[model samples]
Target: MTTISALPLLDGTSIPALGLGVYKVDDTTARNSVTTALEAGYRLVDTASFYRNERGVGRALKDSGVLRDDVYVTTKLWNDAHGRGKTRRAFKDSVKRLNTAPDLYLIHWPCPARGLYAETWRALVELRDDGRVRSIGVSNFQRHHLETIIEDSGEVPVLNQIELHPYLQQRELRAFHAEHRIVTQAWSPLGRGAVLADETIVAIAAAHRVSPAQVILRWHLDLGVAVIPKSVTPDRIRANLDVNGFALTPDDHDRIAALDRGARVGSHPDEVK
Candidate 1:
């Protein structure tokens, strides 16, 4: 099992730097996947109402015999639930489906066209104040959206979950996060398998006698960012967590850095709504 490390958030809470992401997997698959990941030493699990498998994630945590406090489970409020009351209901529903309080809760998107993320953020603030969630943050929020929330609530988010990878590195946003002391969590940390076949990454993996995916995951960790790579297959899940054994060379890191081409396999944060 790999010894994944943790990164501290602005609020003093810490999250596992490597995690399991259940994006399109069904509830049954999600449950089994979480179980497999936990057995492989993953302590963080990322889910969302948009994923529609919180119950499966919750069940796996319960059945895996891992203490709830030992695992960090994160879920997000969907975009439609952007108002004060809707946000509250959505959170309650998420909790119900999760069958336990989420360690971290996040606003899924800025949804700029709705003009309601600020209100949604306020609701998350209230949840944190109620001690229902250990930390609160956002997903796919740009700098301006983050500024609006901090300006309105005087509270900085614990982290921002975004579509980050070798491609679409979001250098400016990461710089902004570093300045504010907010953790940056990458959702599609592998670029949805696009980077797995990259010549540079493949070469690095060959040099290290590891998989290309491991090289990419290690690259994210080397940058001090959190990554949640999704896979239901047991071998890949285990391999993803098996990145702690090796370190990337400076020359290899530079070659992988050169692969950034501002590509995105997912939606742009500004246009998500």
Candidate 2:
């Protein structure tokens, strides 16, 4: 089994750097996948209320026999729940479905069009203060959105989850995160499988005798970004966590970095709101 290391938070909390993502995975598959991941030594599981599988993830955690404090669970509040009042209620509902308190809670999207994320962020801060969640963060937030929240809430988020891969290097945003002491978390570290067939990544994988997926994951790890790659298959779940053994060389890292095309597969934070 793989023994993944943990990354420290700004608050001195430790989170497993590699986690199992449960996006688009249904209840049955989520249960099996999360259970398999836990058994394979993964202590972190990422899910969202939008994914509609929190109940299954909850079930798997309970059945896996792992102590709640032993695993790091993360979930997000949806766009519609971006108000102070609604944000509070949303977290309660999510916790009910999760059957456990999440180690980290995030605002799923900035949803600036609705003009309520600042209020939502305030609510998250309240949640953290009230002991409902250990940490609070934002997802899909660009640097500007992050600035808005920081300005309004007067508290920096612990993480900013975004779409990051070899093709879409978010250098400027990452720099801002680092400057502010916020950790950058990669939502689609594999480029949604697009980079798996790339000649550069494939060549690297061949040289390392690893799969293309493992190669991409290793790149994220070397970059110091937390990654949550989702897979319903048991083999893929195990494979995703088996990324700690290999180290990418500096030359290999530069080769992958040059593959950046600035392409993003997900919706822009500004467009979504």
TM-score of 2: 0.98
lDDT of 1 at 221: 94
TM-score of each: 0.99, 0.98
Which regions of candidate 1 are displaced past 4 Å? none
Candidate 1: 10-residue stretch with minimal lDDT: 1-10
List, residue by residue over 14-95, the lDDT tens digit for candidate 1.
9999999999999999999999999999999999999999999989989999999999999999999999899889999999
Residue ranges of candidate 2 with Cα displaced over 4 Å: none
Clashes of 2: 0
Per-residue lDDT tens digits for candidate 2, residues 39-139, read 99999999999999999999999999989889999999999888999999999999999999999999999988999988999999999999999999989
Candidate 2 — worst ten consecutive residues by lDDT sum? 1-10
lDDT, residue 172, candidate 2: 95
